[model samples]
Target chain A: MSTTATAIDNKKGLWRGGVSPFKASYGKLMMWFFLLSDAFTFSTLLVTYAFIRWSAPAYKGEASDFVFSTEYWPIPEKVYEAFPGFHGVELPLVFVGLMTFILIMSSVTMVLAVEAGHRMDRKSVVKWMLWTIIGGIAFLGCQAWEWTHFINGTEAGTIGDVVKNGLWINNYEIHGANLTFNQYGPPAFAALFFFITGFHGFHVFSGVVINVIIFFNSATGMYERRGHYEMIEKVGLYWHFVDLVWVFVFTFFYLI
Target chain B: MEQVSNVVVQPADRKKIWGIWKVALILFIVTSIEYVFAFTMSKGMLLNVIFVTLTIVKATYIVSEFMHLGHEIKSLMYSIILPMLFIVWLIVSLVNIEGAAIKGARGTQDFTGSNGATEQVDEGH
Candidate 1:
């Protein structure tokens, strides 16, 4: 007869009727689905890359080390050595390491943002979210720089007695990357590199855009009106998922 | 930082924040270990095992801590992780079959031009 009695009457069995199977909100469940699907897409790309590399003929340098090989799959270490600003320095994997650090730090900030959101602390959430967006943008910029350097190789090629494109040490054509030519090693290498990293970059870019929206909403006290910060937590889940995929991508594509 | 120290914050909340930071530190250390091994270790079964093992370790931490899956109900967690096993199956089967085919084809013919004349096992550069 009373409101409390009515509320208690509405309660159903744990496993049927109106109960949530996973104890997760509808939006959060949907986010998990999105992330799972995204995970499949990325893993497929990476595994296909592995399969293709497996299929390719081995390239061993005269020293027989894959690191300095001029043939076969170009050496992973040799091809990715160009650091930003210091043009000719042979700093292998340093740039990538820096990028990894950036992504990891961004992920950390995202969790912090979600933590702030839990307390209904609008200012803290905004601050942490802004840092995350900045980190994402910086990552995209770094990827652009990496792609530019890779497509327009610095490895010089020597023909007979003359040195053509003195820094052209890579296998693909100099200038930029494309469908047919990749200075790195095999055409497939550049293609996969482009497709995979580009896909991840696009995710980060979209995340930044969404972050801005949430940042705006949080600034305007939208969640405050709703009496919850679940939205921020949901987006935080997505952000961290992106970061997780990058860990796999970095390991498979670069570190391996 | 100062705001986090406000009197309104509970000690339990502070502990949770510190726990997150601890996991972050662990992630950093593991990644650094991966980097060091990448250069020092050669490509082989052992190295591959190490890399895969380390990757799983990193993934566990991320899923458990950052995603808060560690606190999730068993049904929810299993539903998310159990299905990913199929992907691993795909990786193993495809790489094995494809790699074998490539090796067979390679033995019968050489398409790498002059580099094809070199020995199968190369020394370091």
Candidate 2:
């Protein structure tokens, strides 16, 4: 009877309140919840983008029909062709691919940093954190270049087509994209581009900031003083979340 | 996790390094395949299916592996992931209804107009 009671007590303790899934702490669980909420927001935006893209007409009017002729949508390949130096050549999807690769590499470094943190190795954590920050900076630089190119746009429309008011009249004058006008096909395309990428870029910017802070803390041996490097792992969760979002964004915007 | 007097910090999980590398490798390979499809496949049902499937695969892998959710208690994992099915349902139904509305509008709306076309609203005017 004593042994049975002890066994019941142990089981109660183990299953108390509820099984803590994976023994995850409150912070990690909350992080998952936060990520889940953010997922919904992102998915809505992307799904709407698809809905708009699918419903909208590809080419608005005919080239021969001068009065009605205006192309509203630019093909993804055509818009994203030129690389930074090779502006003259049409190299589609290459630059975005590079950006994606950089982000992925950063994620790898972050994982390594976390791995090092698990071992309580401060030097390895700092090194990996520094590399991860550099990768983040590089990705942001590439995005800046991309945004500039997108805003400036390329020459669009036919020869006779001219800018009437802000709208492309006979011709679609390729200009920097904004709320009102841009040269890259439809205004919605540019608008959606700005909204989606802008949001993601903001996340990256904040991630970098958090990374820098943690990097400084790790350098100063803050986690070491606490006898644990859980901070690194926490920030790591955030970093990986950022990378995961990027994966989705890359697919929605660039690839498909 | 609650702390106790005897609670000792465990050594770093060394084996996770290998797992991370494998997941990263898989993600990279899948992305490469996506690029291949982008250049080769014309836009169609098959292309869409491939993109969605690969994207889901990549996402699930990232969530499970990188986030370490897969190692978590089964109930916790289920609690988190099961709700996402509703999100998928929401997206599908909304897109379907909205798409049907817009595609139907194509019949009534004359897109070949010379006026400055804004969004759908400006198009009509």
Candidate 3:
């Protein structure tokens, strides 16, 4: 009849419904589950992307010998060469690489914030969170520019005969990607690009918004008054999950 | 109602902080290697295998080090990762089956034509 701590400890109340078997708080556990579901969502999208690309005829010949043709799937390096401010330079994969670096750095800052929060260092949390926000916005900016280029496309008017880096200059006059057509090989190419990257971008956008809220909360000493910074750690999980998704996206969407 | 915060605030752990930077460095190095392969290595199955493997490595570091799941109990880690392993298996097999089916049915035909020519219809708008 002893309902004491020693009794519960000795009894191993793991399945007795008084302990967390996973050793994680309820909020953190739920966040992990949510990320698992999100991982499924992203995996399906990328899998679909791979399926569609695989079904199509792959570009044959050397990578450098690649060309834009409606007859075959476009090589990724050929399509993603346009860099900001250095237009017309065939700097393949550079911009997206920079974007990846930005997201990775932001994730690092978020972890630092969580580390500072463990010590209830409000000042460091604010500083690191602010940097994380900046990195997210910068990433979004890069995405916006990339989307514009994809949508607007290279000067639309040249005849289809003029092939630049494999893309026909005048394919139906309206170049780039849109709701109905894709100048980059197959329609699914642009469609999947927009859908997958756009979905990931939305996640990044929401992550930034949440970071801002956490930043405000930490800045105002909310956690200080409450005596713990568990909230930062939870959000840090979400922020890092976003980064994890990007690592896969960078590989599947761009690198492959 | 005031909810009691039972969590204890610990002092800064410099070793843990340094460990984080080390993981970050590892991630950066892996990404740089991918970039180098992307440009220097030609596109093929070998390059793809390298990229996918590196990506998984980066993902592991993020989930383990940054998300701190690596420090969690074994049950929790397995609960998350085991399901993911199944999901990945499903995706790989399904994508292969579906992709092969489509390719077999189409046989390199120019199906991209006309469907991608919708711009001609919408040009006036």
Candidate 4:
């Protein structure tokens, strides 16, 4: 009779109040809390980007004049304008568009994985997570290509002769035989770009690692034994956060 | 134990998937509009307002639907968004301060024919 009463009490406790389907273990809850804090960190960085862009001195010259391949602060589109096999043509924002699509598709795959988890379909979960990881790798590859293009000036002309206006004019030269303020608008721009993107990329890399581990576990039926796929759901939250951050990056860093 | 079984047995309406898809479609449409506006419109005061508005709309959908913040308790919602208000306040104040500093520097440069050091020395020891 005592055991029956205890069982009844446990049952009553389960739904006495509103309960969340996502109420998992403590580790999962803590992960959500940590992600909330991390979200604030990224927001601070992006807000700082807005502040700096607003505070910078505006030059009357055209954006192409003072951007990449010159001694001026890079115009984002010019710096990231790579499109394979269409060499020597200045097509703006093509690569960024591709990167955005990759990220969105990865996000779609992540949702599919989460849906599979809800259905307790381990095979589907693993399959979709693999696709999501592939999407992440593709994005990282695109970023690497972008970084390379940025470091090595395009064939428009040699590096030092480029001016603030995307023109490869002959007169402009890096003072003191090295590129400095005269070539780039300010050192802060490049420094911030590398730091922010590098930090975000690091997050993506870590996310992929976590996803792979989860995939392996699911494939081995570890989660099935545990009777839930909450781990996948927790990781999905992290993946979505990464995608959210990239949307901001696309808008602020690329389009703006 | 009984209530746990009941909760598990309660079938979630599969129609919720359609609602999720609707939210996603709205987000995509808004983002596409933002892209179009950005590419076609010249940068100016009006464009800035429009872009910021559209961005907020997209952010709203992501936060509410994708993040599931809408399903959360009202207090939790306030806790998250209230801090963001403070961030917005800080951004506004800092931008104003920086703007003032730049204006002051430019004024000194225009009047003194130098970057303000001579004026400082003349007024000081």
Candidate 5:
């Protein structure tokens, strides 16, 4: 009878308000909740993007026949084809692919740092954190370059039946994309591009700042003195969340 | 204070480290596949389906392995994931009906006049 009472007490103890039912540290649990909210925010953004893209009329004809026009949605491949140094050379998806690779590599490095932290290896954590920071900066640099290219309209030649002003005016030169107008297609395309990628970029920027702070904290043996490195794990979760969001952004924006 | 003391920090092991690299490798491979498809395949529903599926695959690996959610308690994991299902539902329903309504209202082909000759005037502009 005493054993039964104890078992009942044990089962009830989970909800007795003294124990953590989830078995997660308070900070970590709060971080997860924060991340969950963030996921909803990103979801709304991407869903809006998808809705807009879907509502736009699909481009018809061969991929090679695609030209900038108000009449149809622009082919993503044709619009995003310009390579930085190679300028006019059409290298579709390569640069964005490189950006994706950079973000993923940084994410891996962050995981390594967290892993090292688990072992209480402050030296390894600092080293890996440094690499993660470098990777984050590199990605931001590439995004900056890409944005510059986007703003500065490409060389103005009407490539095969490009339309302007809702009429096929002769000598219609292509202007770079802005929120007001997009030489690519509808103005909404450029607007969404700016909003979505800009928002994601801002997240990356803030993540790098936080990462730097944590890197210093680890390097100076703050966690070491505390006898734990849970801080790294929490920050690592944030870093990985950034990467996860990028995976979706890359797919919806570039690949699809 | 006692709850805080209960926080357990698992030490790193070789197997777990290997698992991280394996996930990274999978992500790299999936992205490469996406690139190949982007160039080779014609734009259509089939291609979009493929890309979306592959993207989910990549997202799963990142969330499960990199974020370490898969190793967490089942309730914690479900608490995070179950809410996201609403997002999926939102995408499926909203994008389908609203997107079609928008396309119908705007009628790009009808409004802009795809042919060079038709001087169709759009009053909304």
Candidate 6:
């Protein structure tokens, strides 16, 4: 048989074997579809955020009208304004900036790892993957800190002064606690914030773990033996998806 | 694997990965803009509009550059972006409806409470 005939025969045999029908590789295609679905999920959450904010009565107070007080949707700056120490200075949204920076940096490292994979540079691939993992961990740390600050409620002693009302207003008392429902905007807002951001944070944590494993595998030449590092690209897709969702969260939840 | 055609199969052109420093620079610039806006702009409808616009721009850069989605096929891009837009529309409509209901409820509650008390006082007198 000629070379062309032999190639055609092999193609026919493989087709008859009844393998997966996807035109692209299974991993890459799946990542694309997964990202598409995830995009929808995030959009729903953001939309829900908007709906709640709109439906909830808006208090006429400015963002800085209250400090460390749960009064009026908790002001993104007031809820997230911590930075290691420097307590009582009231720096709003500074920690969120740190979190955003960390995630973006991790994304940069992830892209570098994907590039190194394309170049088949095992050493660089491992190194960049490790860096990416570190960045992910750092982001998770920032998230944990933000969560702690939020759940602990800033200035616990003042809780008695707030009254329960639908409106989130400053100086309101809820159930004799200084933190009124009005001051905090609504309970649903805090609940959704925790759920959505916590879910994203969990994804980041998992991504870091997966990156660590890939880093080790690359370090030991496992993918070199397999002759491909497509895994890196797939993980990069997930990492990017996480970052993309954060953009929406920051825009709708924080900035808006 | 059909008969491997004799046509020239050019190697896929790999795009250059943006440098970390450049990515860092972009992040810094975006964050600085966010900070400046947060501090300089008072909270209101104008601030809300500007903040959301800037956020979308920053997000686009991150998605296109960091995620490398810019190199993807047109179909793939639409598959992602279109569904997201729909979700946004749905959420906005729902929120607006709820806002109207709450406003109505608050108005009714105030009217009934005051009217009921007045009727009872007139009967007592």
The lDDT for every candidate, in the order shown, is 0.75, 0.76, 0.82, 0.65, 0.82, 0.66
Model 1 chain A is weakest, by summed lDDT over 10 consecutive residues, at: A157-166
Which of the two candidates, 5 or 6, achieves a greater lDDT against the reference? 5
The sequence of per-residue lDDT tens digits that candidate 1 reaches over residues B14-51 is 88789888888998999999989988876656877787
RMSD (Cα, Å) for all candidates, in order, is 6.0, 6.2, 6.3, 7.9, 5.8, 8.5
Using alpha carbons, what is the TM-score of model 3? 0.87
What value does the lDDT take at residue A167 in candidate 5?
67
Candidate 4 CAPRI-style tier: incorrect
Candidate 3 vs candidate 6, lDDT winner: 3
Error of 4 at A164 (Å): 19
Better of 2 and 4 by lDDT: 2
The residue-by-residue lDDT of candidate 5 on A40-64, one tens digit each, is 9999999898898888766666666
Model 1, runs deviating above 4 Å: A1-11, A61-71, A155-176, B1-12, B106-116, B119-125
* Cα lDDT tens digits for candidate 4, B10-123: 233468656666766776777778778866876555866776677667667766776666776676667667876786577556655764475456442211223334221111
* Candidate 6 local lDDT, A43-100, one digit each (tens): 6677666766664444445443453333234456655556778777666677787778
What's the candidate order when arranged by decreasing DockQ?
A: 5, 3, 2, 1, 6, 4
Residue A136, candidate 2: Cα error in Å is: 0.9
Query: Model 4 Cα displacement at B51 (Å)?
Result: 2.8
Which stretches in model 4 have alpha-carbon errors above 4 Å? A1-25, A61-74, A156-184, B1-21, B96-125
Candidate 1, residue B54: Cα displacement in angstroms equals 1.0
Report DockQ per prediction, comma-separated: 0.32, 0.34, 0.40, 0.15, 0.42, 0.25
**How does each model score on TM-score?**
0.85, 0.83, 0.87, 0.76, 0.87, 0.77
Report the lDDT tens digits of candidate 4 across residue range A115-134: 77777777678898999899
Q: What TM-score does the predicted chain A of each candidate obtain versus native chain A?
A: 0.87, 0.84, 0.89, 0.79, 0.88, 0.80
**True-vs-predicted CA distance for residue A47, candidate 3, Å:** 1.3
Over the stretch A129-181, how does candidate 2's per-residue lDDT look in tens digits? 99999999999999999998887766552232434676656434445677655
Residue pair clashes in candidate 2: A22-B73, A72-A186, A151-A176, A161-A170, A161-A171, A162-A170, A162-A171
Q: Which candidate tops lDDT? A: 3
